[model samples]
Target: MTTPSPSPRLAGHLLVECLIAQGVKDVFGVPGESYLAVLDGFHVHADAIRFVVNRQEGGAAYMAEAVGKLTGKPGVCFVTRGPGATNASIGVHTAFQDSTPMVLFVGDVASDTRDREAFQEVDFSAFFGPSTKGMAKRVERIDDAARIPEAVARAFMTAQSGRPGPVVVVLPEDMLTQAVPDALKALPALNPPQAWSDPGSLRSLRQMLLQARQPLVVAGGSGWTPQATSALHRFAENWQLPVANAFRFQDLFDNRHPQYAGDMGLGTDPGLRRRVSEADLLLVIGARMGEATTAGYTLLDVPVPKQTLVHIHVDAAELGRVYQPALSIQASMANAAKSLEGLTAPPDVPWAEWTASAHADYLASLNGAAAAKVCEGTLDMAAIIRTLSETLPPDAVISNGAGNFATWLHRFFQYRSLSQGLKIQLAPTNGAMGYGVPAGIAAALTTGRPVVTLTGDGDFLMNGQELATAVQHGVKTHVVVLLNNSSYGTIRMHQERAYPTHVLASDLRNPDFCALAKAYGYEAEKIEETSGFAPALARAMARRGGTLIELTFDVQALTTRQTLSGIRDAKGH
Candidate 1:
């Protein structure tokens, strides 16, 4: 009746074709038998897309998340079901809270054995259910070989859609080997849908700005390109507003700019917090104003802020999800920034003095305005951060995992503008530990730029094995590990306040990190004082391979502002 169907092709090979069609250059994951066909497909199309083998599922997922932050597309990661999927959930949660676009492919058990709960079988949808409290934005399973194109396309689109986040696609082991019609093809690459601010909303935003005597712009969140960041710079410059980046999104604005008002997060400047609370108008662009950025919801009143809020975000659902704003504009960050840049500013603004004062506060905070309260040992963290700020290239990619150790980096290291080249900061807003090493490796691999990761002794070990991935890939990344021989420094800081001198489960018996790095084929050194750090860093920067520098400090150096006992005394403990 009809011409014979073209020779069938393995669904795994077709899946790789779909990814290649979507312009994916690399896939990060661990090899597993459940997805052996997909692994073979990767080999078949190795020239089109490189498969990066990671030491663990979490590291693989983190690397994918970092790639998503850097590229504004869905960074893809593959893992087998059950433990692999559960292990990869950390990165998914990080991506969700950080608003980074990512796609995690979980190879599930064969369709026949799925409900039986066979070995390594898992129901991914329930595990990664999407909700305000859940980890992923969407979860789906591809049960048919012919529908691979549709599933893959939708997954990518869902990940990059409004309020970008991670999407989970479960692939059955049997489906990967199924033969599909050779004629079937992948859908074209999809671009993130851009929602533009309407003229009326833009007018309202302008009117609000005009009426305000003191206004502050909080900029941060994912989906920012160089062009968008440049537009944001122009918008800030045009209005002469003092801009404070939200939480971990420090590189969104050039910290060197006079209008830079510092970062808003843990260890926030007291002056900046005062300004946020006192500002007549809060023009929040891209930032969700989450608990961390709002100092656990203490800075800004919940449900309804005291300040006249003009909240512009990409997703409509996020507008009134927490604080009801005076004006809410649902538009992509790129479009919103572009529209704001187009809006003309008056010749003289009343908040000029206010803006100047905010910037001055930021500068003073940078100079250790509160350093007198804290006592340090052999090494000074602030000084080390300052050295990094001065030595690294303007476009160097800096990343860190969660820890009190990051406070120094956040406070002292000034980030260059993203317009310089790429997203320079890769810290997770979700406060995920063990994120820095894999993120740094991903940045170095994707951007081919100088990469530096800052981590604490505990944070580094979370995904420190990823160092092997970096060494195997021959990517250059300098890792600075703060050796205090403790895990949960942040928790310990709180413990000292809540229960003084009763530390338990926080102290760590750490290994010789220097020796571990050497074993991983990396140049390693241990620096006990501030002086040795600069020389070691210089040598690391000059080297051809990866490097790890360990800096030991006293436990009293808990945070950038206060010593460990200082917290205890404040609690009268």
Candidate 2:
């Protein structure tokens, strides 16, 4: 009898093989000693896949999250245990909230040192437990190196299925060193079938549409395929329905379409809000009707809405989780939109005038008298944003973090269409500051598309160090930093509305951003006036290694409509 010789390949190498089998091309991470085997695997398979080195774990996570948004598949990220996992939690939370698919691999301490409180030992399962408010959808640790394929494949599957969220996989350092046999091949990822709309429910929806005088469609959410978007447009055009995007999912709908009603998010258009209230039928296609979308649940309260509610979603668990719908249809967005497109629209919907009014309000709200005047200051933000709209290409990516400075961009910019087959917006629904800089770099590096990032001073500084990552990656994003020296603009607005002039720790002493950006190898410029933006923007687009155009905003230019003094004077009467 002959003894078989053992084939040698590290478990970490097997994990990388599994990722390649699953069609992952790029991964983002910060290097760690615990994951040295995986890094070695990356080195071995360098040509097949690329590992994006990030400055910090948080930025890496954010980059992965943004990649998840750009590409429907789960965004892959690798980080070491304990502190690394803690830092990466922010992106996981954002992915959970935004319904984006992402998989985070945490390299952990050795198996023998688990209970003893070894170096950087922390219970990952306990920390990233699954719950409604939890960080990840699933959290599991792989103790056996042989099961690496099974574990990673499961993570990918769980991350992408149903509601689509983050999954955490813990890898023991000692397990990575174990040699696996060459016969052990990596298994391919399994994707679950999309839930199709019930024919009866869709028919019921059509009947409801026929009966309504004023009907509105709130279109949003992740995983909107091209077929789905086209189907949505056809459905909207067929019935002459007004479609408003949910929260930050503006790119899901064609914003330039006549049927576009406007984005229903923070600072909801007053007229649009009123029209939403006045509507007879609310066909919420993919939107979760989240807090911000429903104006803190005041616009459309749970159990039942003022109008007939047709709630359609991929996840059955999410149907009655919040608002009980008049008719609940369990279906993936593409299937539902495709089914709806198949339905015959009546020759006259009777509410054509009502629909037109809603869209009119949307068009009027953008460049109209009210909107233009709202951005009142020495440096007209509305003019600057509008200039950006005119200057940038339709396919150019626009990303922003949380800020009052974004209000002007939100109000004034008119998104063209997803029909162009490109993701045009990358704003955060979870209200994470410093998301823009990292997201922009990721987008630019990954897509090679022109990227523009809009950020306030406070927001930009959060992960602004990632600008080094951008420069290192040979990607240039036209960065617009609104220099409003403030930590809590949104909080200040609420405080003023509640307690008048009782300001508390909102003001900030910022650095010379222009000089800092220049030091970081960026073509930096400081612009205070509206006219200066065009030239700066043009130069940024033309330049090679990226540019940071700083807008010198006055501290008094608080909100879009009012100054700090005006807000104090009002005392929120």
Q: How accurate locally is residue 408 in candidate 2, as Cα lDDT from 0 to 100?
A: 72
Work out the TM-score per prediction.
0.98, 0.97
What 10-residue stretch in candidate 2 is worst by lDDT? 367-376
* lDDT per residue (tens digit) for residues 1-573 in model 2: 998886789999999999999988889999999989999999999999889999889999999999998888898899998899899988888899899999999999999888898889988877988888678999999999889988888899889888889999999999998999988889977875788988898789889998998899998888788778889999999999989989988877777787889989888888899989998899998888888899999898667787888888888888888888999998888789899999899998888888788888988777534434544556777778888888898778998988887777777788766666888888888888888888888889888888888888888889888888888778855555555545567777777878777778777788988888877777799887778889988988887768898887766666666666777777644
By summed lDDT, the worst window of 10 consecutive residues in model 1 runs over 369-378
- The 0-to-1 C-alpha lDDT of every candidate, in the order given, reads 0.89, 0.85
Q: Which stretches of candidate 1 lie over 4 Å from their true place?
A: 1-5, 369-375
- How do the residues 1-573 of candidate 1 rate in per-residue lDDT, one tens digit apiece? 887869988999999999999889988999888899899999999989999999999999999999999888889999998999999999999999999999999988999887987998777878898998899999999999999999999999999999999999999999999998878999998787899999999998899999999999999887788888899999998999999999999999999999999999998999999999899999999999899999998998888899999899999988998999999999998898899999989998999999899999998998754553453454877778888999998778898999998888999999998887677899999999999989999988877888999988999988889889988887965555555545678888877877788888888889889898889888898888778989988898888778898887778878877877777778786
Top candidate on lDDT is 1
- Among residues 3 or more apart in sequence or in different chains, the pairs in candidate 1 whose N, CA or C atoms overlap within 3 Å are none
Q: Count the backbone clashes (under 3 Å) in each candidate.
A: 0, 0
- Model 1's lDDT to the true fold? 0.89
Give each prediction's root-mean-square deviation over alpha carbons. 1.5, 1.7
